[model samples]
Target: MNFWNRALIIILSLCFLLPVFAADKPNILILGEDAAGDSVPRSSRVFKRVLDALINQMHDKGFDVYDEAVLTLLENNSSHIRRTDSEIIEVARASKRPPIDVVVIFQIYASTQNLEFNTRINTLLMGRLLNVKTGKHLGNFEIDSGKNFTGPAQCQQECILTIVGDKSRILANDLGAVLAEKLVWMNNGDVSEPSKNNKMVTEYALIFDGFNAKEYMAIEEYLVIFSGYTRHRPIEIRHTRSEIWYQSSIGTAKLDRNLNKMLAELDMQSIINFEGNTFTVKRITFRNKEIKENNEVW
Candidate 1:
């Protein structure tokens, strides 16, 4: 075969394979915690066993889990590897190893089976997912196993272990399924409507007074620099004044804070007032010159 034919074959082959390659498994970092908000140390046999089971479950659900052994190595090598969820996230984000896509914090606790019935035991499992890049919480999910397949009335050491094992397996599978669904929604541009725990995207409109055409253009430029808008065109220009509308994944209050910080560097003195979802801006000075204040409703 000639070079052209070979090149054409290669291109066609890559076209067929690229999609599969692009859909790589999500890399997740899992951390185990006991009820007291302390990291379950490596010596804890039960915590390690539960975590291992959870990792296996995650793998079964098509996720690429970072090895617990490797995490232990990191913890031993660095002082940053404590048990808190924040520290785990920090260490995972800073690590130069595999790029972590999601951080999973798992907490397990045992509770009384019932107030009246003291024979059985209840195991509760909770998991929270956090995005590695933004450190934003994606969502929280929970699972509980209550006296599944009762063996012993009062759970002693061995009985407790057996109950915890049963609960951990169920917890791991449930967490993986929930995380998978969340990932699917996120991949399909449904991040704004993710699980109830996350802050939903909000849209706001603002009316600017005394902002001339040049300043309006500058404001539009600054919104582009803000890089928080889901839509590319976030501002609307008008003859007398301009109206700006944008959507942010953060809450309205935080977005307002960021907008104020961005607006401070411009060569304009403006007062911003927020009423409900609408913002009104009045310009006191433009280009270092005081402007005649006007109470105009546009």
Candidate 2:
């Protein structure tokens, strides 16, 4: 096709794709917490690097991701102020920076200090998502990235020797990727709307049908950044029946609303299990479907 013909085809394609593109972008926030003085001893710069990777990736993908992990931790220290959904919204909007459309808040409990020989850190990071205005905990999940996953041979990385920077970029890359995916899922994964009949106005049970940290991470940076939507609350990896309740709330952008609808369109299905050359995306039906997708051995 000639240049003019190509231009005509491009315009037609955009007309078909614009509605999905024009949907609002949720401004996501990242919040990390520890019990006051008990924070990881040398973490001032650690998180910021991770923050950059996540935000940069998400930005490239299409969402407006904000780094608010620092401020939220400071707020957690204050006693009198009860963080309401509205306050969350204000916090998001108050940002001379963009508002945190969806939040990735984590209260980490790490057991790396207890190690002796081949020091392995077992961390239980409970990641919670909140709507900025309402203090509604959209979803919460446990992100368990055990340092032991690294083989002894892999531990030979000379660059991984820093006591403070013990966790390698590879680990960070994996964790960041997974977290990014979950962030995406939280921001965009299909959510079964909480019953409006409830006396409480906050919605509960933000779910990803089948959960895989990596699966969710791969798409997170891409969708939220490129798709123009905020992340919903991210749920942890677990097996349970009852809805995961919201511990706090935050207001959402117009993009978040559309994300919920997109997830709903996914039929609320997600990847649940990983087997050799096979993967499963589950829905509420509990019926398992195996899909054959291509993968290359790099």
Candidate 3:
């Protein structure tokens, strides 16, 4: 091919590949929670309206939002599945769709006060941002809708509609901005330095079941050199179960892989499970005695 023809081919190939290699914006999923930290039904009118408002705000900020209806569909399709905050993670992990990077859990509280002339409606919106991949708490925000005076005969539902319609944008904007900034920092792996404490650390709960004292000691020795390990304190140590408060900069997923790999290397058959910031290690036994341990490590 001629020089100019070859140059044109190269330029066309670059154009086609650039978009594929571009960095994608993080995917966000918003969920509603109740006072007891349980998942609030999305069917509630208040929850639906507030969720729509938040979704609009996020969209305006150029974020890709996951439809909550997909979660409902997943639940309905699975007979044994019940939707909850923690269960959402497991469901997301099992699905083949794009992974959810951040989850926003929000709660809404509304109340009315009676006055001689009219009733005053007040609403409070509380939200928390969590990083799904690392199970890290990003931040929390609380926003209140200023007093809205309505007729004395105004019902709770009418009051909720009035206040939420008027203040939803404000609430969404405040929380959305914070969430956007935190997402950037998390994506860049930039954890803020501790102001009060001199060290940067995250606390995790570690539990071991069916391991002997000698095995526990060996595990501790390995932990001391684990990646991002700072320190740990033993809460309880027993043959049946043991607990330790571990401090590290790494997430539970990484820690789980590391511990399991160490166990295999030591010829200890075990199963490691993790939920959020807690990890549980259980020793497995086999009668054949010829079973092979997994050689894979992440």
Task: Please list the residue runs of candidate 1 whose C-alpha ends up more than 4 Å from where it truly belongs after superposition.
Answer: 1-25, 35-43, 71-82, 113-118, 146-154, 189-298
Runs off by more than 4 Å, candidate 2: 1-22, 41-43, 67-90, 113-118, 147-298
1-298 per-residue lDDT for model 3 (tens digits): 4558756864663454221102434557887665343332344555667787777666555555677667445442334323456766554444323345577877776667777767776667777887676677878887777656354654566665665556655666676666656665555643233211454456677888987554676788899899888656555556557787677877767888899889988887888887866788888876554334212210
| Per-model TM against the reference | 0.47, 0.38, 0.47
Q: Which one wins on lDDT?
A: 3
Off by over 4 Å in 3: 1-24, 35-41, 71-84, 146-156, 188-298
- Clash totals for all candidate models: 0, 42, 0
lDDT of 1 by residue, 1-298 (tens): 5558756864663465321212433357887654263333434555666677767766555455777556446543333333566566776676433456677787776644432334466667778888776777888888777445344555566766666666666666777677656665655522322212454545567677777654666676766666455432223444447665554556667767766775787756678898866677777764324323222211
Query: What are the root-mean-square deviations of the candidates from the true structure over C-alphas?
Result: 18.6, 21.6, 19.1
Lowest summed lDDT across 10 adjacent residues in model 3 is found at 289-298
Better of 2 and 3 by lDDT: 3
**What lDDT does each candidate get?**
0.60, 0.42, 0.64
Candidate 3 root-mean-square deviation in Å: 19.1
